[model samples]
Target: MTCHICNTPSNESFQVKVLFKYDVTYYRCHECGFIQTESPYWLPEAYASAITSLDIGLVSRNVRWAPTVEAMIRKWFQPEGPFLDYGGGYGLFVRMMRDRGFPFIRQDQYCENLFAKHFDVTDQPAGKTYELVTAFEVFEHLADPVATVGEMLRAGKSILFTTKVLPNPNVTPETWWYFIPETGQHVALYSLESLHRLANRFGLQLYSDQHDLHLMTAKPINPTWFRWFTHPRKVALYNYLHSYPAKSLLDHDFQAVSDSVRKQPLKDLI
Candidate 1:
């Protein structure tokens, strides 16, 4: 198999089991240190079922952290215009933003909300551009993250994304449940360095805050106060940071994402 991100051959890479039902296997690239499933096929029906079983409340929690995200968004892309929520599931975040008065569009494979639009990152409309685009918990599922992100950059002026970052190099398939290769969904694993490398490759500046969530904002330049945030050791850092005095930022971030969603024209898919 070939490494999806760097296109290097995966002949000597170590294999890790990800999921049980689907029998997914991921290969860790020796050259780029990227972990991904080998020749994985997308089983939409199975994936959809898995997603449906997840708690809706957990998905809605993005609203609680919106303020901090918004502050970062404003610092990066001050003038928020048309925005797109790539892979926005069930329009919960979109609905939250609409309620808060931000005009934005929601696109996902499964969502059918009136406020939602359907779009695939690999097959986006030509000439469509946005002031901001957000994709939370979406990158790890990709087979070719480099190509996927390149398409996102082509479709937007700025991007706000969140995903779990692997910090420990020693935690192998036996120690981490996330590294299991059985489920082909989470093919790519990233660290802060890998994420930054991706941003640099696409000419985007990245700012990441570790809280109960991994909030990452990427644009053409680094946002103000970005240098002050501590690097995340794990996803748990997000929860720890939010418990401190900085918790107020979460509300603001939620408002910003919500406000951006309300301004979008519901009729336009692009």
Candidate 2:
């Protein structure tokens, strides 16, 4: 297979062993650092159905990290009129925003009833843009991330995205236990540099936590926290105060901060 990003030849680099008759292979491109599943054994037919059947409680647990994410969004994006939750599974983020009285639209490829818009990365509407579009944990599964991000940029004024980044250079079969073999998913691995190049190619400003999160804005706007709190002590304190919690006063405080921050005007910043 050819490299999806740079169009270079991809060579077999590793193999991911699954159940019997379900071994998966991966190829790497030295030119662009793009990794992908080799052809002939991609996503299984039950993949979409499995996604649709995810337990609501389990899905809600995923949003336990929402307070920190909300802070990141508030810091980067000025929450404006209408937002689109691209690839919004179960519409949890939309529901969260709606609970806070914010208008939102949800879209998913598998389930039609849950989505206000039904479009893929290559099939979005022209001339229809939004204030913000968020795709949490969605990029790693795409076959062509550049094309996906391009369409995302066209659909939104700015975008906020999060995906688990590859932390090491050495690619081995056992190192990728978190990824599923039959899914053909999580094909692309991103580093901070690669992500910046892709975003810069489309004129988007990138801000990454590098721990496991990435946030980008379309314009040259830098978030307040990125600029103001520089000291390690100060940053640590801030993070502690806003950190994800199972339950406590700190959690409530973070929620209050998010609610107040979201109410701020987006027009002033953009």
Candidate 3:
């Protein structure tokens, strides 16, 4: 098997009995440290429900990460510009970001845009570039990781994505909860080494907390703040400072403020 991300030949690493039904084969590529399951024949059944039952924390996860994403944008990316939530499930993150004042657009072919219907990218003008694109918790679900990341790069110069890296060699696949076979949605998994290969292949700089949150950008980020955020204590402090009552600058405005209030010269009629 060839690694989907790096196109390196991979050897069969292990196999798992998915949902106690399908016996799945997993292959690992030493060149990129990428692991992938064989062609997902069970995908239709797996994705019948856009949000799987195993993903119960979907809403809360978006809520919790909203502040973190905001902080990253304030520190690294420009405050204003288009933002897209790729593979944005239910448009929750897009709505949350929009609510927090960022002009976020939602794009998810499989799932319904339940929250941010007004901000669909499909309705927007074509060839519109975004400042940043977020693909939180979506990378692992990709069958073609490289193609998806390439598309994201085209959509924006920077991406803030979330995916839990595979644990060390000491941990066996049977012990890892991330490879939930019942859902059969998580086909590709990447390690830090694999991500670095991706960054190098695409000529992008890679930054991460070495776990879940990661960023790939063509522009240089403030290393000082980036390094600071790598620490859990510092991140917690940042989160606390930005939480409720300290309104985010990107908070969404439901109405068109420009149209609601009359222009000064025209207001005499009212």
Candidate 4:
């Protein structure tokens, strides 16, 4: 079959037991170094629930990534421009960003918006552009990387996303946590070089922490500065030392929601 990224013929790489049941075969793209599971017919069963039960790190991960992202956004992008959290789960990260004074909205086709009600891409005006789009830990689950990335680029020129890069000498099936066999959702995997090819496809510059976090943008960025901005501990320290954004939307959100509730039909409220 053809690689989704480059449309080159891909070769079978390995087979693994996914969802602890189905035996799955994965293919490696010779041209792009991308790996994909063979035509994921199991996805219907796999995504019976959008956020799998195996994802225990969801909350802690959001907390850990928030400060670093906040610092990076404050450093590079416009702080007040509208932003979107692509594939955002339960609206947690979007709520967090809004609390920090960034005008952010959640965009998830699958997940339920449980936390930040009234803040979704569907709620926004059509043809609206964004200052930036963030898609953390969502790349591996993409069934069609090229099409999805194409949609994101249409919305914004900059994308900050996260996906674990397959390491050199890669790991045994038993050791590769990125495989995520139980959930059967991580259908595609990529290396740093593969990600670079992805960025180049759209004429965007790619900067990675050489691990999970990456930024693809039209703007120029110094590699060293990008590294510094994404550093977790330093960002945590800076967050602790300084008052971030200097304002919270706590009262504003309260007032807005109150107004919306007042405007709704009495029967609708009930």
TM-score of every prediction relative to native: 0.68, 0.69, 0.85, 0.94
lDDT of 1 by residue, 1-270 (tens): 776655677553455433454545556656556666666665463375445343354454575445444444444553344567777766566555544445456766644543333223323465778777788777877767888887777768567777766656544667766553544456677766567667777666656653223333343444335533333232234435443322232355566647766787887426
Relative to the true structure, candidate 1 reaches a TM of 0.68
Instruction: Report the lDDT of model 1 for residue 265.
Output: 88
lDDT of each: 0.57, 0.60, 0.80, 0.86
lDDT of 3 at 174: 72
Q: Following a full C-alpha superposition, what root-mean-square deviation does model 3 have from the true structure?
A: 6.2
Q: Is candidate 2 or candidate 4 better by TM-score?
A: 4
lDDT value, residue 210 of candidate 1: 38
Candidate 3: segments with Cα more than 4 A from true spot: 230-253, 256-270
Give the winner by TM-score: 4
1-270 in candidate 4: lDDT tens per residue?
A: 898888899988889999989999988887878889988889888988999888998998888788877877777888887898999989999888888887888999878998787889998999789999999999999989988999998888899999999885444477777898889999989988889988989999899999998999988888887787677788876666655545777678779889999999999988
- Compared with the true structure, what per-residue lDDT tens digits does model 2 show for residues 16-93? 754335566778777656577765344555354635332345355445444444444445554444567787776666
- In what order do the candidates fall by lDDT, top score first? 4, 3, 2, 1
Backbone clashes in candidate 4 total 0
Model 4 per-residue lDDT at 215: 96
